[model samples]
Target: MSYTPVYFSLREFVDPAIFAARGNNCWQLLSPEILRAADWLRGIFGPITVNNSYNGGRYSESGLRRWESTVGAKYSQHKFGRALDLKFRAPVTPQQVYAHILANQADARAHGITTVEDINSTPTWLHIDCRNWADQDVPVMVKVVQP
Candidate 1:
């Protein structure tokens, strides 16, 4: 049941350096859960931007980040390809999306979204990750954390 994104391209999910080094093989670095979740978000939230560098935009660290990258925490889920920072278009905001996910826990869980960074911590973007919470004995509700 591996899921590939229909609304996104491989270049949109990785940094320019990674895309240049691994090409399409970079897809191997991204988790299927994260990929599926991204597509699901797009279907529900309309247009969303991950890494727009592929299209000459400035965003490149919104998705999978390199281990050596200093953009986030040393152990950030973005480095493990289990997370994404999405910037939504007009008619929708990150806070709104975050509220929707929190309000629809079951739906978010079904889409493999185990965590969402707190809206206050990430006011401009919605950061969702598929980090494994089973080993942590966390409850079924999507865990909201401060990045």
Candidate 2:
């Protein structure tokens, strides 16, 4: 097994809304694979808009409830430091981002990574995750989700 170093962050918060909503600022950990995946995604997108990444463990209960009503569970990969949700510029669908990720999946897999659709099956964002295990490519959906 590849040794994935544990990364501890001193940042006050990971997700803004979660922080504003929950009134807490703390993080658990993130693996190296997840960091590599995040770096690869940022490089591919080239300063694209981002929705969420590395969430802090501080959110108002009500805010978390509201978030869950839409996105489900305040605790997620974003909080765990192994995932990223990206937003595209105008006229670009989430499916397009997913397709882009899939197109580059070959290279991504080489670094032990994978991507998935946005929550609620909407094509507004794409979620990418990385793990220390450099295994085979995990099957992912590359279809466009229309609103």
- Largest TM-score belongs to which candidate? 1
| Residues 11-92, model 2: lDDT tens digits | 3213544544444232334345655554565565554344323343323221112233344445544545555455555566
The lDDT for every candidate, in the order shown, is 0.92, 0.46
Q: Which 10-residue window of candidate 2 scores lowest in summed lDDT?
A: 57-66
Estimate TM-scores for all models: 0.95, 0.50
In the range 49-134, model 1's lDDT, one tens digit per residue, is 99998899989999999889999899999999999999999889999999999999889888889999999999899999999886
Candidate 2: where is the Cα deviation over 4 Å? 1-13, 16-28, 51-70, 73-75, 91-93, 118-120, 131-147
Query: Listing every candidate in turn, what is its Cα RMSD in Å to the true structure after a full C-alpha superposition?
Result: 1.4, 7.6
Instruction: Report the number of backbone clashes for model 2.
Output: 4
Judged by whole-model lDDT over C-alpha atoms, candidate 2 comes out at 0.46
**Collision pairs in model 1:** none
